[model samples]
Target: MSASTSAPANSAPVAHNALPPPSTSSAARSSRIAPHSHIKGLGLSPEGFANLDTAGFIGQNNAREACGVVVDLVKSRKFSGRALLLAGAPGTGKTALALAISHELGAKVPFCPMVGSEVYSTEVKKTEVLAEVFRRAIGLRIKETKEVYEGEVTELTPSESENPLSGYGKTVSHVIVGLKTVKGTKQLRLDPSIYEAILKEKIVVGDVIYVEANTGAVKRVGRSDAYASSYDLESETYVPLPKGDVHKRKELVQDVTLGDLDAANARPQGGQDIMSVMGSLVKSGRTEVTDKLRREVNKVVKSYVDQGVAEVVPGVVFIDEVHMLDIECFTYLNALLESPMAPTVIFATNRGNALVRGTTDVISPHGIPVDLLDRCLIVKTDSYTREQVSKVVQLRANVEGLKFGDGVLDKLAGEGEKSSLRYALQLLTPASILASLAGRTQIDIDDISEMNELFLDAKTSASMISESGAAFGS
Candidate 1:
């Protein structure tokens, strides 16, 4: 044997066995295992955490204080159970405060306004829609456990004594065995476990799931309502149960993530479409369906409550030209504020009588119900002072990366008594554009002069030109 082992001179040596190298495709797949690895720990990025000072505004102190109160409530979980309202005139920063709360909570959801005739129209069945909208808005999800039971059979026995009486000592016996069958309904609790599960799975409203019992066939339940209504799932559906079997089993059979606003808005024109639908209804000249419209609006709001989102972060429904709301709409508004989940509402109107009933009602006509008004935090936004207007122009110019010559801000601010923050910003836009066209890196006295000529030449060209010259020292 040893001699034979050395004698294969022409034969090739045995090749050493080894594993093949990994393929490039397999390597690429393994590399992709951490797609989001770069994004980890990016919460509250630096840009998102930037702080802006609101102190330039006159009432900022009051506004900030109010914001602090809301923040405190949220931190204490009080806001999780109740709603808050801020009522004020336009440009008074009511919306700003709402945004601040959302920011403080680190909430990505937006503050959606409850307005438009479609929101109140009967044609839309507003409550259900509103509920759906709220659920969509908050991105709420719900999951439930269901139980099932199986059927069992028992056989009856005949007594030997009865048989003996009839048939001379015949004996008989009956046997009974219990068999478990699948058939029964189970009540599920809306607890933290379900919420955590939903959050973990990223489940949202409008999803469908199968309801299962411990020992029976599974039933399907659709998430037609908001997450808050998950507690009432059993009452809203039907399931079969065996005649004598009562045992039940529960499990999460399936889940489907909902197609909510976030998903919709991810596409082009989603917000535009929503606004168009609501806006057209509001602009409709006829008041024929006002009652039906109001009911629908309330219905939609109720759905928001059912999903727990409304109660957690209620909106501020601002009604511009509020006096135009019909009596029925006003009445509904009053009722809505009383709802546990309805948004805090604010109405703006030039006509005081629209909300008042009698001659003695001398306060501004938009008199909300006393109880509702008591709950409202109201602030009156007054016209800007000359000095305030000047500051606004200067600040706006700076914001545009424009460098104004001495006194040019004063000149722009003195344009007219009606000059406003909006107007100042508008003027800056054009002036900056002209400066760019003129090969200037920054807005200067010349840009303001040109803007003045364009906007106020007819009123006081001489005064404006003189001011411009003085500002430029030309």
Candidate 2:
């Protein structure tokens, strides 16, 4: 038996276009770059107090000021031989200070960061690793002005003829390319190889491009902005037209590392053919750079610097957990610091008095030798106060797209004071999840209490384990 229910006779149907269409907008992205991604600068004001924006720093005023002084010294080219050492307890903002310094130094300056444990390698020697890092921290900015043709490509045509070697095929003899600039226009008859390069670059009419005067190299900048407005939506990159004549002199700038130069010189090309490329792909390992070759490269770099064709840029090398390096590496660093080409070095450690890694009878400050320590300007980061910890918790919550209810941040800071700052920071995500599960946008004290019941801090866990020695089947 089937029974059917009748629909309501007075119900009105909604029209397909009853409401205005939803507005189109770019999606707002939540930035979860890192725990400390919100840090933009040193957060220091002109009088050296905290700035109004805070700049991601809540405390550590002394350390930030010291780093500001270091930045000034670095910019003036007066910082050499002596390295900056940041010594503090774990969870203090040591690495954050280094990052702030790099940001202040400008984007063009190279900043090489590494961990001391990364120096250990089965296939590479330790000294070679150190030397490689030293070379990588140096940069060369080469600037040259050359005559070239650059503009939007108004027309592109290739003239082909019958191949002499193969009658069934045709080869491009020469390409007729027309370029239009703001000031003028020019027509060029380029070689067939340049045409091939143009094809390889996916260049076509309405794209802005440039050709090298001497090398005849074709480089496509982007699609001209004049053609960009024709499409309601596009995926191609667009650039404004150049502001000069089609045939004119242009300045070209290239920034490269000394390590890059060393690698280029270390590996000699097999050939330009496909077989040579396949052979290269089949045999792959780390390239070995020699001392003699490095010296030659340095001489060439010096010559270029003297000829006003290039300038040497002193960069920064930050080694975190630097106490992991042993006596030999420290000795090498002492000599390396005296070199004329050494980069600015910054060493960070969370250790106090400890045994040096490679030594049996030696125990020194921060696990470093006295001589090396003497060559360092030590900056110490202090532990955060309760207020600072609360501020830091708020900053972190903002970074992770979480909100706090009344008294939640203060409760978290108190927990941090009792246990540790890191442990307190670790609870924010889980607390946020608990809040989400409760169908609330703001994390409350009850969520924090639930997290505390689920997860124990290090001290609490250690105490519990000691109280029940045999429970773990030890």
lDDT of 1 by residue, 398-433 (tens): 544567656767767676334444555567766655
lDDT string for model 2 (233-271, tens) is 678999999888998899899999999899899986888
Please report the candidate that would top lDDT against the real structure: 2
Q: Model 2: which ten-residue window has the lowest total lDDT?
A: 1-10
Lowest summed lDDT over 10 consecutive residues: which window, candidate 1? Answer: 33-42
Stretches > 4 Å off in candidate 2: 1-32, 47-53, 229-233, 271-279, 282-284, 470-474
**Cα miss at 218, model 1 (Å)?**
25
Q: What's each prediction's TM-score? A: 0.43, 0.88
RMSD of each: 22.9, 7.9
Local distance difference test scores for all models: 0.44, 0.86
